[model samples]
Target: EAGRRNLLGLRFPPKYGGRGLRWEDEIVAIGRTANTASLNADGLGIKLGEHGEVHVNASLQTTIPHIYAIGDVIRGAGLAHQAMAEAELVVEALQGAQVDATSLIVPACIYTHPEVATVGLSEEQMRAETDAVIVGEFPLRASGRAVTCNEVEGWVKIVGDKRTGKLRGVHIYASHASELISEATLAIAQGLTIDQYVKQVHPHPTISEALGEAGWVALNKPLHVPRIQRKRLRK
Candidate 1:
């Protein structure tokens, strides 16, 4: 049945087994399943002592100021990009640039089917922390480029601070979402407002426009999605 569904390019409903799992959850499930099957998992590593990771301060300095740590050894998502960012922070600090390492926004991406990528807080997290949150979403099905590529399987979501109009997060679940997330990461990291993001002109009929469209939707100024559809998304 699953094979037939795949052959027909049809996905089962989530209740039966469609795309129901979050990217992180899927990774954990794969690791656990691999362990159960006694497979040599790529993530298997040395079980370090109780104080495994060397704790770092805002300046990336370890508990002992003289020592410093970065990359996978630190308590982070362990992505190469994160390591590179931390490395730059450390270099700036060394050069007496007065860097604040904690301010860095590390973007994460899961390169799965209909890639998942995100930067900053999620809707759930933002809602829990603050009531004044605005969410805007652009379904890929409405995107010209997505339809052209026949990869309109997901959406792009932007979470903003309603009171401040500052972009708080950007999440994408679509083809090339990993690449699309960088723009959002920059927006969030630089504290760009929704207006600022939307004002910039995005090339027509491109996946990148999804981000801009989402920004407009959050502000209740959608251009592509009909009013009825907008209302449904707001709900």
Candidate 2:
């Protein structure tokens, strides 16, 4: 039985796998996947849907020009920071500043063991959208701070555009990754190149240095990790 459990790619039928359950039953088994409880907006006379979401324009203006919406109520990730950013945009638009909300970079973080954080285009997205892409990574095991803290189990990865050398994305899986991702968000927002990122000096023995080192890796001048060699294909 232990050997059977260790077998790879095992499949089970209804009798053993619970496959005979109805779709609704399966949903219950897995756990409910439903939106948060939302109040209808019609009662407020705001022309909202049953979920209390309002459709807004790039400036966050609603169907009624005078009204504006932001946050989870405006159809986006229900994060407070995102809502705050959108609120700022709405204020700017109201002040007659021409705003383009689509270009906004919203950073996301997951607080877990070896925290995960990300901003901007992912590697898969860049490969699909751009002509050429470069990626670099620095493992936490190479980080002095991570080593000292005895929590070296993650990495920092940077994605860049090969044509322009501008940073396209940054992803991190490490202790305090959520905090470190703010730097990445700023880099993507400013269109910083790998060279520029490497130039910014990071404090020694700090986890933040992992980001700078990863930029160095992307530029093929890694300070800590050995460079990876690729086999050239002969024509």
Candidate 3:
């Protein structure tokens, strides 16, 4: 049954996120990504870590101080957006603005059949960092958008600090997880709590709505999933 549904989806991809995209004009590849840093500062004598990634300071400077390194050359998620953010920070530092080279809000995504997108701390990482944590999940099966697309195999999970109600992370496994995660990244980066996040309205009949629903589930004021299930979501 799962196989049939997946094959059907591949044959006729749904226009998720309200875009008029077509699978007929797409190229697909399957493989593991082995990304390495691009370093050309050899003659300049740049210091490298054990893994050979360039070592930089809070200002993204090499051991030489005058030199700077950003993007894949440094230890990070090796994402283009991350590299761009680092570049912007570097430019600000050069202009004498206070900047933090480290501590980037890098969101990751696996662009597969059921895309995986996430930002902020994971449940395990959150548990280790904070004393209290709560997780709220909204299954794709419960989403009206998912039902319309006939692809309801994944879920959206939200992690938050129970004490402060501040949203810690957003993890999504759905068709347009990549497209849906930008909002989550902003929320986590700005340190918006569940209370603040849920106050913003999500449009009806959309996959993004599941994120708000997950927040509601976390606050024990769920409007989509079973109310009793919210208890087991906390740690």
Candidate 4:
């Protein structure tokens, strides 16, 4: 039945057997993009789960104050593009470009049937790592493409540092997780807060717009997802 359902290519997974295991379209897109990007998984082997971090090939620097490292050696997602970006950043810094590597945020893509992509930290990770963390999620049901394609079964989750009100992470379980995560990555990298994102208008009926909605939801002004609605009662 699962095979049949998968073969049928239904937007949702089979309910009889795979009940509750809703396939995320965002994960599917992540995997597809990862494959096209030629990011091999054999080297990484899923050693890290969201916050997994490890440093490899360390060497002290005489001219520079900090040590230099590169490649999949540094723990986290083992995508080549990310590695290349790090390499470039380091090279630029070494050349006295005054680049800031601390602000770089990497995006993750699962690329499964439904697709799953995330940047920075997950809600689970935030809870485990920080005491002051606020999370907000918005469903893809508000997206017109999802409704038009009959594939609106996922959501976007944003994790923010409550103390600083900075976006720490963004996770999405939708049709195009890979593409949608870029905006979130940029926001987190730039230390943009939820309130700032809310002011930016996103085009209607788009999955990317869900990111904006999620940002609003984090700050208590959710749209499309009524469950998290924030209302100020009259005193």
Best by lDDT: 3
Q: Write model 3 residue lDDT over 148-233, tens digit each, in one string.
A: 99988778889999988899999999998999999999998888999999898888889999999899888888887888854336
Write candidate 1's Cα lDDT for 1-235 as tens digits. Answer: 5554433234557522375332212223422111112311123432222335445778888655655678766666778998998999888888887877789998999998989999999888988978888888888888999999999888888888888899999999899999888888888888899989999898988999999999999888898887456422223
Q: Point out the worst 10-residue segment of candidate 4 by lDDT.
A: 31-40
Candidate 1 vs candidate 4: the TM-score winner is: 1
TM-score of each: 0.78, 0.76, 0.80, 0.67
Q: Would you give me the overall lDDT of model 3?
A: 0.82
Per residue, candidate 4 scores C-alpha lDDT tens digits across 44-132 of: 34232233333332221212246455545455466777778878877886787766554567787988767999889877787787778
Candidate 2 lDDT over 80-169, as tens digits, reads 789888888888988899887777888988888879999988888988987588888888888989999998878888888888899989
Best-to-worst order by TM-score is 3, 1, 2, 4
lDDT at position 207, candidate 2: 96
- Cα-based lDDT at residue 57, candidate 1: 77
Please report how far candidate 2 places residue 83 from its true position, in Å: 0.4
Count of residue pairs whose backbone atoms collide, per candidate: 0, 0, 1, 17
The candidate that wins on TM-score is: 3
What TM value does model 1 have? 0.78
Alpha-carbon lDDT of model 1: 0.78
